[model samples]
Target: MTADERMAAARASGPPAPGERPSIAPAGRLGSLLVSSGQTAVGADGRLIAEGRVGAEIDLAEARRCAWQCTLNVLDAVRADVGGLERIASTVRLTVYVAGVPEFTDQHLVADAATECLLRVLGPEVGRHARAAIGVAALPTGSPVEVEAVFELA
Candidate 1:
């Protein structure tokens, strides 16, 4: 089903069934956590299609998963929020931040996870943007990764 359709169905079913949601990681800073809710936009089913969050605590493997999922979540939101994905004129930029220990400096690797995901989804269009992957002491919600993008809308 289309993302919108999937969202609608989810909404019809009401909040996720037990265990359907990814557990919230411990809040590190800013008091209560501020997650993306994974849903960038409401699909036709009236369900918000949240694919991932800004900061989550997970193993490196889970961090990688979160990177991919977060990018997809943004892409899905972009499509749903801006009318449709086809309307995307150009990908102007993507900025990814990874929270890690002082010893962990492979920020580029984590950033690529999201970059590659966007490339697979946006095709050559992904080539037209600037990207940065930086390591930070912490993210808003102890989220392992946070991704932001600037797309030229058609």
Candidate 2:
């Protein structure tokens, strides 16, 4: 499948639910840069996809799936902001937050799933980017994983 098709299939459930405050901010552009608001593992219908701490309640595999969903949400935000994915020159960076126990040291491993998802849909060129994976005690909406990204505008 093409990138667009892959993205659509991955997001088969639909885009993230809109909030009183939109996830794709109105002012999403700054010169050649485009920013996406952080997205959690919320389903298209506004339900949390993965809840609780990763190590405590959810396993690594579940956390990884949640991370993939979060990145797909970010892509949807970018698509909304830019009018098309073609406008994205490249992914600049990604920040992934995983709620987990203090002993959890595999946040980076969870983040790899997100990166792989991006690469699968957007190709290596656009998907390659710097990333940070952080383990936190909690996250908004009790989501196990959240992802936010920056892209360079074409």
Candidate 3:
């Protein structure tokens, strides 16, 4: 799906639960770059889509889905910040955080879900970017995953 299509779908799905603010500035402009705050796997219902640590209460598959949800939240924030996704030139950086138990080393794989969603909605050239996947002891709101990004404005 294109970014517009993805945005339309998210709108049709409905806004997040009322009164729940984004964890940080959805997106902010610093010169030509748009820096996005970290987003968790919050659903439209205003609930964490997946909770607990990977390799523990949350499995890889579910964590991957949560990663995708976080990506959508990021996109929503980007749209609100830039006028439209068309104004985005290309992704500059992506950072994925996975709450995981000790010895859980597949953090990069979990992060791929967010990258895949970006590519699917924004196209390959624009979505491709440098990335880092981190494993952490815990995450905010108990979410299994969180995603943050930076993009260049066209």
Candidate 4:
């Protein structure tokens, strides 16, 4: 969606409850996160950018399916929050966190599921940023995967 449309849509969705915040705070110093955890809108240089989450206990699946669902939902939430797909400036970065068992060291391979999903949704622009796939004991909503993005506004 265009930045304006996305912003407007984001304003409409309001924000998720504070308790619903995803544990997306990657270890980095990005000048204080623009939005807090679980927040659908984030501010960067005063610009309000929006993101969304999708998943509940009912959405969980095996690793591969979970990964695909996560990426799709991330884009779905983005589109819903932002509006249409014609206004995106760039995808700055994406971080995917998966809840897996101790033997799930294959986290990177599973992460590919998310990247592929983004490629289909965002096209070549998906190649513009760095990414990471991490394994954890649990996700905010017990989801198998939770994806988040950093976007550049037009």
Candidate 5:
């Protein structure tokens, strides 16, 4: 499907609710760079896709799905800011935060979900980027994962 088609499908599946606006700036221009605010795994229903800490209240697979959801939210924010995903030149960076127990060492695997989603949506060339996977004690709204990105405009 085309980017527009994918976006429409996502909206139809339920996101942003009716008349709901983004809680953050979404994306901001810093010279030629576009930086997005951190996005959590909140679903269209306004609840975290996966909650609690990985290795305790949540599992790796669920954490990965949460990360993917966060990635989608980032894409929505980027699209809203730039008018089109086609305007994205390259994904400069991705920072994924996984809420998990200190013993959890699979944070990178959780982050891979976001990377995979970007590759699928934006293609390899533009999706390839520097990334960091971090493990934290907690996340906003009890979400298991959150993602933030920086992109350059085409």
Candidate 6:
């Protein structure tokens, strides 16, 4: 599918699911760079697509889905704040935080979904980035994963 189609499919359109949603502010620009706030897998109804620790409460596939959803949120937030996706010159960095049990060690695998989604949407020229995938004890609202991004403006 085309990038726009992919984006539309990810969004699935309409309002968020009815659940707890963080108060998110738009990404801010510092010089020619745009830095985004944290985004989770919260669906259109404002509820996390899946809640709990990754290794204990959810499987790898489910955690991957959450990471993908978080990526979409980051892209949308950047698009919203910068007027258009084309305004993005390049993806400078992506930081993925995965909440999981103490024994979990597949945080990088979970982050791969976000990386793939970003490449699909923005293409490699603009999407390739420096990244970190960190496993954490807990995350706000019990989300499985959260993502933040830094982008260079055109």
Candidate 3: Cα lDDT at 76: 92
Error of 1 at 83 (Å): 1.2
Model 5 — which ten-residue stretch has the worst lDDT? 15-24
How many clashes does each candidate structure show, in the order listed? Answer: 9, 0, 0, 6, 0, 7
- TM-score of every prediction relative to native: 0.60, 0.83, 0.84, 0.58, 0.84, 0.84
lDDT of 3 at 39: 95
For candidate 5, write residues 1-154 as lDDT tens digits.
9999999999888776667775557778998799988999999998887779999999999999999999999999999998999999999999999999999999999999999999999999999999999999998889899899999998
lDDT (Cα, tens digit) per residue for candidate 6, span 1-154: 9999978987886565789475768687899999999998999889889999988889999999999999999999998898899999999999999999999999999999999999999999999999999999999889999999999999
Tens digits of per-residue lDDT, candidate 1, 63-102, equal 6665776677677666655566676666777777777777
For candidate 6, report its TM-score: 0.84
List lDDT for all candidates, in order: 0.62, 0.89, 0.93, 0.55, 0.93, 0.94
Deviation from native of the Cα of residue 5 in model 6, angstroms: 50
- The residue pairs that clash in candidate 1, if any, are 8-45, 8-46, 38-50, 38-51, 39-49, 39-50, 55-143, 56-143, 56-144
Clashing pairs in 2: none
lDDT of 3 by residue, 1-154 (tens): 9999999999898878978775666778999999898999999999998789999999989999999999999999999988899988999999999999998999999999999999999999999999999999999889989999999999
Deviation from native of the Cα of residue 32 in model 1, angstroms? 34
Off by over 4 Å in 3: 1-23
lDDT of 2 by residue, 21-41 (tens): 443373267899988888899
- Answer with 2 or 5, whichever has the higher TM-score: 5
Q: State the weakest 10-residue window (summed lDDT) of model 1.
A: 26-35
Residue 86 in candidate 2, Cα distance off native in Å: 1.1
